[model samples]
Target: MPNWVDGHPAESLSIKDRGLAYGDGLFETIAVRAGRPPLLEYHMARLAEGCQRLGIPLDLQLMRTELLAFSAGLGEGVAKLMITRGEGLRGYAPPPVALPRRILQSSPFPVYPQVNGVEGVQLFPCVTRLAEQPLLAGLKHLNRLEQVLARNEWQGSEFAEGLMRDQSGRVIEGVFSNLFIVHEGALITADLSRCGVAGVMRAALLDSARAQGLKVEVRDIPFEDFLQADEVFLCNSLFGVWPVRSVTGHHWPVGPLTRKLQAIARDLLDI
Candidate 1:
């Protein structure tokens, strides 16, 4: 299927579009199944928050309509939705009145080894550290040079993902996923108040854990504490959850809690 720009099928974007010029936008990677996005509500909620935070005007109703139409055409795949501040002059100041641009692109779903979701995977420790930016924290903003750099630090299938940390060496997240650790029967994930993307799958898992009466903690997790976790797992909108087997010299078993939450995530993603 062709890409949609501002709700119509298209092939190219304007040269002056702010998203291209300055990374001035937000985006969501949604998983579509049977002509529908299973996590549409979660994706939209984050997009709404990002629009409000960036003062970018967005029509949620219209976006929803377009997304539904786009997903129907693609059927089973991944839908990438980008909302830009639209075309702008060559400068830092945004246009006095912003006209947000909506872009939708389709791609085939990723194919990972079945062992990743079953037997578990290893993580590579990335040298690139995330910068502290409270204003952009958790928004899934378009500026992702940090993630790009971290992702490139690795070479092959030996590591399924790279573990990213903040400037202070606080364990934050994965290259393209959220991290969660189970310790002494409580679920803990790093707080994104200062950095990191607040992934939709992470939100869904938190909600499901809470609903199931599991102890969940969204707080700052130190590297030492993370290494001490009984079980660790990574999650994203597309891949559901993957039990983390090891990182660096330390190691961890694919514990029962990881399996339980993995089951919840699989159910949520309908995979």
Candidate 2:
């Protein structure tokens, strides 16, 4: 698969790009199926919000066109779209007139153990806590060192994901995915107004749960409260859903609600 920079095939980026210097940009990891992104609108919506918040002038229509063409050519794979605030001088202040650079890259779909999606998996407890940044809370920005550190907390196949919390110790999400819990028949997830990435699959599942008449709540979850959940699950765009069977010393069975939502996610990803 060829990499595209500003809509042309390229393998290199400018040395002074703001995205490399100050992480001044946003990105989207999309799952392409049969020449198209299944959740493109969701990804674009997030990108638009990120661009607006960061004051990056993005050509959404042109990006949509390029993404469609690139994904069509690749046929099947993960499409990574990165928009950076173009090259800058030796300072923190952004350019008075910004010219955003669009980079599109493709990689083969990831392969995970089949048991992970079926029998469920364990979650590693990460000591790395997410800082509360309301301004950049839900945006999939370029700064991801926190997640990098948290992901390295555990090694080996024993743990499929790591559970992350906010600085205040509120259960936030997974290292690379969103966290959801079923409690007393209510489907609850963390309030991303303070931190954590609002994953595309998480959004879709929330809507699906509501449509299926399940009670939904989006609020800050205490660590103790999260541990008492009837069932827990994690989700991301690349890998639909994985039922979290255990984290730390607590354990949860793959309940009916989790299985139902997992099926919904599988259908959404067409896996």
Candidate 3:
């Protein structure tokens, strides 16, 4: 992977950096294909919103210029941008003047099996539940210890992804992807007003699906109701889409809606 710090080639960050000290940062994982980031706007918009909400100063125009330059020679891969609150003293008090640190990284696209999207994949129900934190909900902040713990609950190919639930026992999302269930001819996804990362792919799909006259509901989906869905799928900026064949004991065949949405995602990603 290639990395850059503050728009320059660098490999290390200070130990006093708030990102390392207190996980005080936000990051975006962008998919780059054919030397372009198709959904750059969505990623940038989300990042900007997080910055504003957290009182972090970010130069979006400069970040955009840097992103384009970084991805220019890269054909197909992933680009990660992390903005931290910068170095600070040994206490929790914020510095009077903040100088945010920008770290950009480029890596080769992850190799996933073709069948993961075509034939679907199995999901493991994680025991670790997401804590309700409305303040931090929907933002891709640096605190991902919950996801890391959930992911560690499983190993190997038996389960392609791990499903996480909120403290209320409502299905929230996958460890590394957003969850969507199709039921009664409508698309249903979890409400991220309380928890979960509002993935860029999920946002794009919501718009596209509604534009096509598809019924889409963004609300709390209980575990029981989720199991009764007609079809299920997971999505992220990198993987595109993966139909959920089964979660725990419940099984769902890849339905037409999943395929339809997958096609839309492919077009949006220009794949």
Residue clash pairs of candidate 1: none
- State residue 55's C-alpha deviation in candidate 2, in Å: 0.7
TM agreement with the true structure for every prediction: 0.99, 0.98, 0.98
**What does candidate 3's lDDT look like per residue over 151-229, in tens digits?**
9999898899999999989999999999999999999999999999999999999999999999999999998899899
Q: Pick the candidate with the highest lDDT.
A: 1
Query: On a 0 to 100 scale, what is the lDDT of residue 63 in model 2?
Result: 92
Error of 3 at 265 (Å): 0.9
lDDT of 1 by residue, 1-271 (tens): 6699998888789999999999999999999999999999999999999999998999999999999999999999999999999989889799998899999999999999999999888999999999999999999999999999999999989999999999999999999999999999999999999999999999999999999999999999999999999999999999999999999988999999999999998898899
Candidate 2 residues 1-271, lDDT tens each?
8799999999999989999999999999999999999998899898999999999999999999999999999899999999999998889899999999999999999999989888888999899999999999999999999999998888999999999999989999999999999999999999999999999999999989999899999999999889999999999998898999998778999999889998898898888
Candidate 3 residue-wise lDDT at 96 = 82
Off by over 4 Å in 3: none
| Pairwise lDDT winner, candidates 2 and 3 | 2
Candidate 3 overall Cα lDDT vs. reference? 0.92
Candidate 3's displacement at residue 130, Å, is 0.3
**Which candidate ranks first by TM-score, i.e. highest?**
1
